[model samples]
Target chain A: MLRRIFALMLKEFLALLKDKRSRFVLIIPPLVQLMVFGYAATFDLKHVTYAVFNEDKGSISRDMIAAFHGSPSFQEMPQIERNEQIAVMLDRKTVQMIIHVGPRFTADMLSGRPAPIQIMVDGRNSNTALLIVNYAQDIVNRFNNDWVAGNGGAPPAHIVTRAWFNPNLESRWFFLPGIVGLLTLLVTILVTALSVAREREQGTFDQLLVTPLHPAEILIGKALPGFLIGIGEASLIVMVTVFWFKVPLLGSLLTLYTGVLLFLLSAVGIGLMISSLAVTQQQGMLGAFFFMVPAIILSGFATPIRNMPALVQDLTLLNPMRYFLVVLRGVFLEGTPFHLLIPQFWPLAVIGVVTLAIAGWLFRHRLY
Target chain B: MNNAQMRLLGLIRKEFLQIVRDPSSIAIAFLMPVVLLLLFGYGVSLDSEHVPLGLVVEQPDADTASFTASFGNSRYFSSVPFRNTPEAVDAMMAGRINAVIVLRQDFARRLRQTDGAPIQLVVNGVDANTARIVEGYVTGAWGKWLEHTALQQGQTLNTPVEIVNRVWYNEELESRNFLVPGLIAVIMTLIGALLTAMVMAREWERGTMEALMVTPLAMREVILGKLIPYFILGMGGLALSVAMALWLFHVPLRGSVWLLFATSALFLLTALGMGLLISTVARSQFIAGQLAIITTFLPAFLLSGFIFDINSMPPFVQAITHVIAARYYVAILQTIFLVGNEWSVILPNALALVLLATLFLGLTRLKARKRLE
Candidate 1:
């Protein structure tokens, strides 16, 4: 029985690699998606487009405008002559914001009076808009600080900000660890999910049933390949993330790998369940996506799980990916010790056992 | 009717019958949009609320109590007072709290002095997006609290420059408004690609393509027959999505319904053409499905300006988005949904969608012929 299952595993590998497209599917998409997600899946804005309606032509106002000009974050658009242009340009999305330096100019500030500067912003994507406001506010605060110093009236208070995990707060540090779990889940689920459905559709399952092997042996043979591939894919992505992306892997590799191993087991189990449920490969594919989409969304991969509604937040408890994301980010960034990571580890193990048990029952019954 | 028309009609009937038999296509078309829309609309939010913030105050003073009270009253933070900084930092490391604020023993003492007081804030920046938001909210809350405290003390704070920030379009600043509209493009891309590509590739993999090629019917007629039913199914999804966006999610439709449908029809044709091209290249459903996912679905999800900001990406990646059909479609969808008939935004993207549809369909035609060779 052991030799037969081993032979079946070899046959699975041979079948997957024999097709050039499947080979490409197994290798290229993950790498390409890794690169894409690493670069494109960021919320940080490097360049902000804004038009200046600086009615105040004072030396101080120019000095303030000069501050914005010097910063790499701000890219000054073509000058808007009238207030009307702000609307038109904003409507066309030619500029993300319009910095309207009021006509009062530097007159109010030098005389120890409060002056107002209006920043007309496009709030289409509220996060980007808010970030733009924050960046602008930083520049203005510097200007105000200088004014306070020169006037010999020191500012009331200052914030001493320290970021613990990611010093520069680079978004690359945040998303790379996430892609490791997400892509691993995608590949493992697709591989295991497609195999049984494909064999069933091709009427090869009956031939296997007629053999001396039990359904349990066939299941192990089928699941081992997906588990192996998932581990290999995850390790490759992590290596690339650390070496190529220069994202520091602060925690021990042993800790991270332990999570990866347990996570793959759960992913493989879920995939087998989908495989048992699907009648055709297409149905299998759909089932995989059905699990993956919600799994990913609720995982706090891109969006925070805390921000989700109370019920949805509770729903994420059932997802294995959520715990894995925490493990990945915690290990990569926080250098979280193994003991601290236990809360994330056990859920994946539990999910793995539960799903595999159901898959076994489904396979034995050949139930859809 | 002519023989060619009769053949095309017969093929169309077969495609429709196959769709009826296969429930997955229906699920892909209708059920998928509902699931995707609801998930994106409700589950995914960029807004940061209820961020767990830890406060570590060394000595409790009247001023410190008021400051902590202000923080407690703020909607942005759910503050927990830790015994000390070490506990707060430990909680931050454990992922229980994202930020820690420490007030030294002299927090109230130095506030009235010339050099003012200093408070320490340490944030867990592993999730940079949330960190940036948390930092911004913390700053805003601090500023408001200072102003309120100053007013109560009957001391007018020496105000320098006041910023009047005016936000136009999406005044409520809900990420859902934009995220929902952009998601429609992704849903349509999946429907058009998976339904058309997988079905056609199945015909080839099953050796029915060789059989169909031996017939007197032209390949163009067969292609047309394949395209129409899926096109109708895709449009059905489009209609259902827009209706849900309006009634269910309450997303405002600022543009004309006819114009929205018309442009969507153009974008759907582009997506369908890409699907046909993939199927023609990959004669097996397995390869076709994977290829469709690699070329169309993932790129549409990421590079299409759906969720991620296009301008924030590297210059090269931003340029790569120009070729993605969903990029144009997302721009069109967001414009039609939020900005109304902003022709300058709509026209160029629509024109690109038109060109892309022609390119993909023309390539599909070139790659495909009646011959099995």
Candidate 2:
């Protein structure tokens, strides 16, 4: 039985390799997707255009506008004449933020009165808009410090902020790690989902059944190659994310690999289950998509899982990608130890075991 | 009475039977987008709140303790106490906290000494956008607290500048407002392309194309027969999805219903034609599905500006997006659903879609096997 399983697995691998197109699909798309999505999926907003309505027309306001120009985050667009232009600029998405210094700015500051400047932000892209708002506030706060110190008064209630885990909070660092999980979902599920359907379509599935292989053996045989391919795809993405994108990987290599291995099992298992239900390649593709989209959206790749409502968060508990994303981020960015990763580790293990077992049972039951 | 019309009707009937028999396809077609919308709307949130934070207080004065208490009480942070900054950093790196707030030594003394003390804020910039928001929450809270403290101390530091964030169309900037509407376009494109590509390719693979060619059917009839059913199916899918978006997800429909349906139909024509083109080029269903997915899926998801902003993409990518049918549809959908049915916004995108659809349909011709041989 063991020898027969190995032979069947080898035959499946050979068949996959023989089809040049399938081989290409298995290998090339993952790399391409990694590169495209890695660069494109960034939430880090750069080159935010800001308009300054410097009513004060003083050195203080000019210096503040200069600070906005100095930062890579903000690009100072042409000055707006009327406040209405701010609305137009925002409407056109030409400027993400606008700063307005009041007309009595120099007089107010010289007379020991509070100097108020108005900052207007277009909140279309809320994440980027928030960034612009924060950066603007920082610049203003710095200006306040300089001005107050120059006037021979002490600044009150100094705030010291320390960002934990990811010091730079580079969106790429958080996103790239999650790419491992995303790529796993895309490749493994898609590849496995199509396997049985392709065989059925080509009339080879009957031939495979005629061989002296048990359905369990066939299930393992079908899943292992995809499992291996998923791992390879994940490793490639990890390399690009860590080295090329310069995302920090602070965790142990062993723990990361273990988590990846477990994650692939659940992904492949889900794919095999999708394959068992699909009668045709079209159904298979659709089935994979049915799983992939929800899995991705709910996995906390694009959004924070914590922000999810209670019911949705509970539903995400069933999604293997969620745990895998947690593991990937924990390992890559946080360098979480094995003990620290137990919550993530156990959920993945449970999902892998349950899904593979169900897949095996389905394979046995479905095959004639 | 033409043989072509009969043959085309027969093909469409056969396709519908296949779809009806395959209960999984129907389930997937209807359920996939509904489930995805619900998941995306409820499960995915770009707005950050209640993020875990670590706080380290160096000197325990009344002012320092009160300041720490203020941070702890804020709705944004679920504050966890740490021994020191290094310990907080370690905890943060261990994924225990989203951020850390450190009260420097002599913080109370500094508050008493001057109103211009320098405060340091360090944020983990792994997710740059989220990190920036985390910084905002911390600073916004701190600033408010500082104002109160200054008022108590009889020192007023007033800023003549205030920022008013006016979010138009979507007042709350709810991601759902954007994502739900975008899902309509994305889902429609996927179904039209994937379904047409498979069904059309299957006919060829089964040698039914040769049989159909022998009949008195015109090429136009054959194409129309295949196109109409999937078009109807695509529209049905769109209706179900839109209902889900409005009723279930609560994404408000601000535009004209007629315009939405009209633009969606036009967009479906382009997507269906693209799929037919793939089916014509690929002889096997497998290859057809692969071609369909590559052409339709990536463009619809990534290049279409559904999730990522196209303007932010590299210039070459932006240029390449002009040819993407989904780009036009996404703009149309966003405009209709979010910005309302303004003629100026709708016209250009509708024109682009119509042009692409005509081009794709015109390019996809019925090929004779005799010619190939």
Candidate 3:
């Protein structure tokens, strides 16, 4: 029985890798995605194009404009001559923000009253707008510190921040492991989701049914390729994440591997369940995506689950990707211990077993 | 009817009948976009709110109480009190809290003696974006508390420069305002590419292509036959998504409706042309679907500035965004909806769409002629 399943698994592997297109699909796209998305997925804002509408011609205002010129987050657009240009530039999104330094003339500040600096920003992409605001605020705070220290008054109260897991707060460290789970799931689901459906479409399911493989054996045979492929794909991504991206692998290899194993089991189970229900490869493809998009969104991979509506948050409880994400980030960033990750591990195990059982039942019931 | 037009009509009818029989195409076009839009509009948010923060104040005093109350009153965090730093650290490691704030024993004494007191902030940096926001919120809260304390004591704080913010376009900065519009590009890509590409590839796989080639119909008729019905179907999908964005989600549409429709049609052609190009390359439905996903769909999601900022992206990746059709479409859609009919943004992106549509359709035509010969 084991030998028969092994032979079936070998055939499946060959079928996926033997084709030039399939081989290209397996290796090239994941790497391209990993690299492109790794760089593109950062929340840190830069090259924030803004036209400086400086109203003040004072020395202090000169220093402030100079400070704006130096910030790495900001890039100065060609100076706008009239106020109408601000509207036109912002409306066309040629510039994301416009810094309107009020015409304080340095009179308020040198005389001990606070001068107001108005920041006008295009809020189309609100998160980016917010980050830009924060950065601009930093520049103002630094300027205030210098002006006060030079003039002999004390600086205001400030908090000293020390980030625990990532000292520099590089977003790549946060998003890379999440992408490993995401792309690994994508490849795994596509591989298994199409396996049985391909056989059905090509009139090979009947041929397989008569080959003395029991229903359980057929299910295992169908699942092994996805499971093995998922593991191989995940390991390669994990390596690329650590070595290529330089994201630290803070936890034990034993803990990470345990997570990879359980995560792949659940992924394969979900894939097989989709395969069991699909009649054609197209249906399989569609079904995989139908499950995938919501899974990725709800998994707290890109956005935090806590931010989701309570009903939607409850809905995320059923998603295996959610559990795997915690394990991935925890192990990669937090160096979370084995026992600490057990809560995440058991849910994936539960989801894997339940899904596999459902797939088995669907296969038997769908069969004659 | 003329000979060529008659042949194309017959082929289009057949495609329509096939789509009617298969509900999956309709599902992909209309249903999937609704689900995705609902999720993006309602479920996902970048505005940090109600973050669980661990607060540990040793030897609590009036200063600590007021500071703690300041954090409690702020809308950003829901504070979880920990008895000590170790307890807070344990909670952070367990993922129960996102960050920890510790006020030492001499919290009040230091503030009176010195101008700036040190407040220790330990943030779980696993999610850097959230951590950054959390830090900002904490700083804002601390600053607010200090000003209040200084005012009550009849002392003016030395705040040299005050910041006054004015946010334009999306004044509230709801992520939904832009995401819903950008989503139209993604939804249109799936409907345009998946519908035509897989259907064209299926004909080849099922031996219908050989039957069709044996007919007196020209290859031009065949390509047009494939393009027309799916084009209409994809347009219908876009109209439905636009309606949802405008009315259901209450996302304000600021541009001319006619302009929106015209540019969307151009973008749809670009997407459908991509479908034809993929069918030419991979003649199997399986490969066609995979290729469409890898080339068209994923680029639409990541590289299109749908969620990620293009300016923030590295130079090499930003250069690649030029080739992605959805990038231009997203620009056009966001500009039209959020900003207005700014032809400066629209015309260039529309021209890019035209060029890409022409390039893809020309490539498909060349490849199809070769394969047919």
Candidate 4:
């Protein structure tokens, strides 16, 4: 029985290799997509243009404006006049933020009175706007502390902070790890979903069934090539994310690979199920798409899982992408030990076992 | 009354019969889009909240405990205790927690003194947006605690600066408002492509096209007949999606209904014609489907400016979007739903859709006449 399954698998694999274009598609597109999506998926805001309206023209205002020019995040644009000009610039999105210094700024400080500076930020892209506000606050706080110390006066507030695990909070540290899961979804689903349908379309599926192969033999034979392809695609993406993108990988390679293997099994199972149901290649493609779009959206890749409603979060328990995302991030960024990752790991294993079983049953019953 | 018209009508009747007989296609056509719209609107959100954080306290004093307790009780964080810095860092690196807060042993002593001491909060900055929001929430909570402590000490504490936040258009920042309107454009493209790709291919596969060609029917009549049923189906999808957006998702329809229909019809014509062009070129259902997915689906999803902002993309990507029919449709749909009947926005997008539809329809007609060598 095992020999028969191996023969069937070899035949399917050879057929796939025979089509030069399909083979090129299977290998080349995954790498290309990995590179494209890795670069495109970044949320880090760079080169944010900011404008200053310094009425004081004092050394204090100049020092503050200089801080904005220093950071890589901000590019100081030409100074603007009239408060209304800020609104116009914001509406046109010429500048992301504006710093306004009041006329009495230096005098208030000399007399021991509070000085107020207003920061107006464009909120069109809320995420970027929020970051600009935080960076401005940090600069202002540092300036205040330095001024107080120079004047031989006490600082206003003492903030003692200790940053845990990832002290630097690099953006690449988080996203590169999640790429492993995203690549698995793209390659496994697209490849396997088309496999059976492609065979049926070419009228070769019936020929395989007529041979001395059990339904299980044929199903495993069909699934292994896609499974291997998924692993290869995952590895390529992982390499690009780590080495090329310069994302840190703190966890053990064994843990990451284990999690990825399980994740691919579940993803390939879903694709095979889609293939079994679809009568035509078009239907198969659409079916894969129908499943894929939701999986990606609800997977917590672009957004946080915690933000989802309780019921929706519960629904994600069944989604393999969610667990893989967790596991990928755990192993790649946090260096989470295998024992610590039980919550993420077990869910993926459960999903893989259940989905594979269901796919096997579907394939067996589908051949009418 | 002409034999050609009769033959074209006969083909359309046959297509409709096949569609009705196959329950799967009918179910997929009507049901799938609704499910997708609902899921996209409600299930997918970019907002971040309730992130897990690891907290390490060196002091274990009341003041430190109280500060840590605030984070524990807050809606945004689930605080887990950590033994030391390395363990906490391990948790963060392993993606166990999004952030970690550690209070130094002298936190209470520093607060008692008049001098301001610096507090450090470490965040995983991998997702820059999430990191920013998480940092803001943590600092805001800490700031509130400081204010209360200062008031208790009876010190005339003053906050020198005030920041006012104002959100426009979508004040609540509900993801549904943005996504539901976008779903209409995506679903319309799918229906148009699927319907047209299968129509000519099915006729060829069933060997009925030879009979139709020999009849007195003009090629124009045959194309029109094939398109009419799909046009109705596409319009039906549009109506259902619009109603779902308004009634189900509460996406306000501020634009003119007539304008929406006109623009959507134009967009559908372009999508259907492109699918027809695919069928004409490939002449096989298998290849037609592949061509349809490659041409329609990816471009509609990526280049149409649905999920990603087009202005932020590279110059070449932005230029490529010019030819994608869904790009114009997405803009038109968003404007109609969010900005209302602003003719300035609507007219240009509508005109673009009309131009694209004409181009694709002309191409399909020209391509249909050429036989395989």
lDDT of 1 by residue, B1-373 (tens): 9888888889989988988987898998899999989878888887777788999999998888877776754556688889998888889877889899888999888888888888788898998877877777677666667777777879755557777888777778778888888888888988888777776677777788888888887777777888999999999999999999999998888889999999999999999999998898887766776676567556887789877778878898988899899999888887788778999989999999999999988888888877675
Model 3: lDDT to the true structure: 0.84
lDDT (tens digit, per residue) of candidate 3 on B221-306: 88888898888888888888898899888988888999999999999999999989898778877777677666765678878988
Write the residue-wise lDDT of candidate 2 on A12-51 in tens digits. 7786677677677667877776776677766555577778
TM-score-wise, the better of 2 and 4 is: 2
Q: Which stretches of candidate 4 lie over 4 Å from their true place?
A: A1-3, A14-17, A47-173, A198-207, A339-346, B1-11, B60-74, B78-97, B110-118, B126-128, B145-159, B183-228, B269-332, B342-369
Off by over 4 Å in 2: A50-62, A76-125, A162-165, A201-203, B1-7, B72-75, B81-94, B110-124, B218-220, B291-299, B320-324, B358-363, B366-373
Q: How well is candidate 4 docked (DockQ)?
A: 0.32
CA shift of A208, model 1, Å: 1.6
Worst 10 residues of 3 chain B by lDDT: B364-373
Interface C-alpha root-mean-square deviation, candidates in order: 1.9, 3.4, 1.7, 4.2
Instruction: Report lDDT (CA) for all predictions.
Output: 0.84, 0.74, 0.84, 0.71
Pairs of residues at least 3 apart in sequence or in different chains that clash in candidate 1: none
Q: Give stretches of model 3 more than 4 Å off.
A: B370-373
Cα lDDT tens digits, model 4, A1-368, are: 87877887787678566755556656775565555445544454456687988788667667767867887767789998787887667655567688888888777666666778877775433444455677777667567656756777564344444333345655545655665676677777756787787777667777877877777788888888878878887887888888887776778988888888888888888888888777776678778767776787678876677777788889888888888887787677657788876787788778777767777777556764
For residue B120, model 2's alpha carbon misses the true position, in angstroms, by 6.1
